[model samples]
Target: MALPAPNPRAMLADRGYDSDGFRQDLLIHGILPVIPSRKGRSVPQSLNQKAV
Candidate 1:
């Protein structure tokens, strides 16, 4: 059976979830994504470590 989607204020994830599409989806759902950027990315994104 298909499970229901989650409705969370924020999401904590690792670099594996560091994708533009994924981040955008989370924002659209009103969820704050706390995922760090992966290595080898041209522009390194700044992350709030304290929030993790």
Candidate 2:
């Protein structure tokens, strides 16, 4: 599989990819993850639409 760009600005994903692990991975890679939070989450996550 092709690797991602050297330095991605951010990552956009659906609720399926909404998880702390995944978000942490993105941060570790220096990329911001813009994914909607799943239902029933203890703390709902807010999305910054302007950044997207």
Candidate 3:
């Protein structure tokens, strides 16, 4: 059987979905991706410092 259409505003994700390619694919499909960045990758200092 074929998969049903996803909601226009739905979020799609997976643990491996943190890459730029995956995020871009979600944008192309008009869906939001709530995937967090992989660890050890540097993020903005303000964002990370504040968390610490």
What TM-score would each prediction reach against the true structure? 0.71, 0.78, 0.54
**Taking the candidates one at a time, how many backbone clashes does each contain?**
0, 0, 0
lDDT of 1 by residue, 6-50 (tens): 767777888999988998998898888888899977887667656
lDDT tens readout by residue for model 2, 7-52: 7888888899989998998889888888889996899787756555
lDDT of all predictions: 0.80, 0.83, 0.55
Q: Which ten contiguous residues of candidate 2 have the minimum total lDDT?
A: 43-52
Deviation of model 3 at 23, angstroms: 0.3
- Kindly indicate the candidate among 1 and 2 with the higher lDDT: 2
Residues 6-41, model 3: lDDT tens digits: 555545444455676766786798766665566755
Collision count of model 3: 0
Q: Which regions of candidate 2 fall more than 4 Å away from where they truly are?
A: 1-4
Listed per candidate, the RMSD to the true structure in angstroms reads 3.6, 2.4, 7.2
Worst 10 contiguous positions by lDDT, candidate 1 = 43-52
Candidate number with the higher TM-score (1 or 2): 2
Quick one: RMSD of model 1? 3.6
